[model samples]
Target: MRILRTDIQILRAIAVLSVLVFHFDLPGLQKGFLGVDIFFVISGYLMSRVIIDEMDAGRFSPAAFYFRRARRLLPAAMAMFAVVTAVVPFALTMGALHDYVQQLLGALAFGANLVLWAQSGYFDGQATLKPLLHTWSLALEEQYYFVLPLALALIGRRWRAAGLVGLLVASLLACQWWLRRDPSGAFYLLPTRAWELLLGSVCALPGLSARLPHREGRSSIGFDSGWLWLPIMAWCLLRGVDSVHPRTDALLVCLSTAGLILQPSAMLQSTRPWMRPLQWIGDVSYSLYLVHWPLIALAKNIWLQKVPDTVLWALLGLSFVLAQLSYQHVEQRYRNLPTPRALLRQMVWLLVPLLLAMGALALHMHMHNHSQAGGVAQGQQPVYGFDARCDQEGDFEPLPACMNTPRPHTMVWGDSYAMHLIPALQASPPDGGVIQATRSACGPSLDMARQSPQDPPDRGQRCIQFNRSVLAYLRQHPEIDVVVLSGRWQYYLDDPVVDARGRFIHPGQHEIAASFARVVQQLKAMHKRVVLVSPPVLLGPDVDLGLCGQRAAQGLLTVMRTLQTHCAFERSLWETRQAKVNAMLTDAGQLADIDMIALDAFNCDDRHCVTVMDGVPLYRDFGHFSQDGARLLGLRMKLGQKLRASAR
Candidate 1:
């Protein structure tokens, strides 16, 4: 009744291997994420073929289709989830456990994609820490399955082609629009992704393959363009791991995959000896995909360093072996039950119970973390800024400084760095209360063209509008003086260097200086006193002290901290890394006649720059201060005295 294509199996192998290689950090497989796009196309084709064939035969059942999917996908997925849940208490810190619990809940409910979409940018530094992040693809596929059958049935035998074409066109358009506007939504949601799957469905249409001429050397079905597909794969690989993304950029890969499936030639179908291993991996690919990421995450969490090649190879071997075991035992064992009713019963008995248990565990961990956090005094919470605008970046809304300020006098402006200064400014308000006009990545730099890729999309535009509004507010009220400018100035200098005169210099230090100059000039034109605050000393991996402190302070799941040592690095390391940016800031201050405040000058010694001082951790993470750390910094810097003098 059903014909299995060896070529399709080969493609499956290719897809899985690419993904594995990418996740394993194998060099040159940067575009290995294209494997997922390949999978989407394959899924679309295979599911459509099966559904269409059944419908034509007058034997199709939507209930039976979904039952088959649940049986095939859920068993292995749930098993992997169970293992992750068990590993959490042992491997994850309480804070991490709380976060993972939320992800786990999302995974179980077929909403992991949505959860990840909302949590943070997919390419964020924290993405590697999430074991369930790979599940977003699975969630996306499952959501597709939910609606496909009904849509196909509604199209009927007569209009299936037209309907699928319309669907594909609409979805592709939506994906293009959304990718530019809201990349995360386009990436994770089914509506934007439906077209890729439907492309495969289009390939499976009854007479689609009849059009391609058969070639003798390239097997029975002779569409021999094997070399053509290479360029497509190469284009995808060129994108690399950091740049792996979807939408229009993914169209080429998806179309190529569809072309391969639709026109399988001898070039594609040859079952050579070297290809056997790939076919084998293909057989167990789903299982491998499920198990590999969590293993990598667990290893990273424990080691807290880059995994060595030797260990990575060993992990790869282990993942393959485990995948074989899972494929044979769990996936195959449960994939075929006696009947639909029996399968449903097993799903209810086994799958439902597992999901419920994980959900409950996640809920319990989340509540425990919240309760522990509740015990700390509210004032001790880290302050970035009091204004709602400070936390969120958006279009400007004019508001009086007195809205959040007890006495509106000084204003803090910059990026997230400015937010950290809020504590000190609040501790010692200016003649009027200190107000904050800040965005997370919105530096005070007037140059809108130099926005960071790490920043939110439209950040450049938002920064421009925000700066314009702030300048307008300053002009409107001469009462608000003493503008304290603070941000991670070093961040902007992370690009290719240019010279002081804006000439192309090697790793140039001048752009940051120029940016600072522009910002200071604008504020100075308004006759506002500009105070430049130096960035806090940045640290390495040891800076994730909050999680360590949480474990030590609150023994969640019996995690005990034996030592009082804080995360710190040598003063030399800090000076070496920050010297250029520091020089730029100091120069900017001198040229602009602005008062520059150096926190590092007081906090660091020649020996080592401690992350903690007198039992209070100076940093919550790598750069930002914790609430207690901020309070202590305010006192140590004598920010109140400085602000009072500056105001005078």
Candidate 2:
């Protein structure tokens, strides 16, 4: 019986390609992470087939099923882990090394997804530092495999479909509810993801699979013929780079895969010419998925410089070759072991080497840590001045602490960048104490979120409400004189939302100009003085200034060489990316008839922007200033003089 369909292989290819494209950050593949959802569905179907068929024949064992899953998936995973552990000393920072060891322990225990969910932000920069991050999905699948046989045995063959459907509904509800409460947990944990697997299992039920249409003749054309394109088209239209996962979009991805499984026709599946390559890729998809991410991550760390397109392509090609080798030698050899006992024995043998490698890496990290412990700075702390009790997020309601203060007539308004500037205000207060009405990610513009659909629904709506509230506050408080605006202005400029015609929509030159005009007009009408703070000197997203400080303890000359050569942002990046932003801010200030404080005057020179000032790190991360940096900036700029003048 040809139980494994060619169409299924094609789907696997699509899933792997989507994931690869997403990780590689290729254009037009924003929602490629949905590939993991597709894999979950496929896994559910395949496992259900084996369990249900065994139940029909009256032969099924949970232990035997688990052994089979281990034989099939573990060898390649352990091999990848061994390779990663060997390279960790050279490729990762000390902090990253400690974190990776923990992730390693989690992966070996089949609890990586849980460990990752608890520790790291899925989309944060830290995620890219861990080579084992992709293991979370494997961990989820392994956990599912652990429970499937037992679940099927309890339900029995005749009642399996009904039981699976009920369970699917429950998981779906749990996923939706948890998604709203804790999206990361819902995304990485198995409970919220179980419905996707069960959805596939529903399609695999004996009666259902038999009933599904499998025509070999003709394929349908146009939207009228089939709804396959509908879900995919909807995904493309709705999803963006910044969109959160496992929401309604996840449901759409799962449903689309289910729809395709039920009807595998030539029309929907690619034509014969494309099928061969896709099938080959599908055959090696498991290995490809395992190797590609770690390779990319390791390369980034090892090079410590911009990887050219040629190098990236070469590395990608190397991943494929390695995947082919692992698939041929390790996966195929162990997968064909004679008995469950034999598979378990082989897994144990493979795991010994991996465990030894991890032990060695841990020892190295421990020694490295102990050696540096004496010199490590004990009291250094990163600065974040925003407190929920005082500075606002999402809404502009004045807190008690902010109200009736000495300088209540002066306001500091912007996002998290604005919040960081609070230390400066506190260090030197103007005539009237500053009233802070700042929210993270909520800028000073009106209705900008409507044009930028990239913001989550809640955040976008909150931004709308918050900006309107700011206007309301100004109208109500005529006594307030100065309104200072600050934010990471380049954020909107660099990530401009585009329309169907490839035209910049949100923060388009005209749209931003208009938005700024409205904001300035509103402030001016209230007879308030507007003060525009220029965008801060930005470092590349990959740079971590604090981490650099830790690395530079050896000597100044060594550190300076690395700093000038490897640690700085490209000169062109500053010249070009910030140019448009500066022009807009300058134009906005002119229209508002306000004074503009250019931050780069103190932070940058003609050649390159400084990352550190007088042996103290200027930035805590890529963008935000540390406490010392903010205080230094305040003193240098004489911001008290500027605000005091606004009070006049």
Best by TM-score: 1
Tens-digit lDDT track for model 2 on 480-570? 8888888766656656443323344556655665676678788877888877776677654655554444334312222222346324544
What is the per-residue lDDT of model 1 for residues 1-648, given as tens digits with 9 covering 90 to 100? 234676777788888888888889888766788889899999988888888889999999887788788788988988888777866666665545656777888987898988888776511325676778899999988988888888988898899999999999999888777766677788888999889999998998998842333232452434476666756766775563244257434788888888777667455566688877877877898999999999888765554435667878999999998899889988888877858777667655556656666776667565655764432223223455565445655644445531355446678777778887777656654456677777766667655423443333455666667677777778887877778888776655664222223333333466567667787888878878878888887643333444443333334332113223444557777777678777888777776777777787656777676655665545555567666667778877778568557531
* Candidate 1: Cα lDDT at 195: 91
- Looking at candidate 2, the ten consecutive residues that score lowest on lDDT are 373-382
Best by lDDT: 1
Error of 2 at 212 (Å): 13
Residue 247, candidate 1: alpha-carbon lDDT: 47
Candidate 1: Cα lDDT at 249: 47
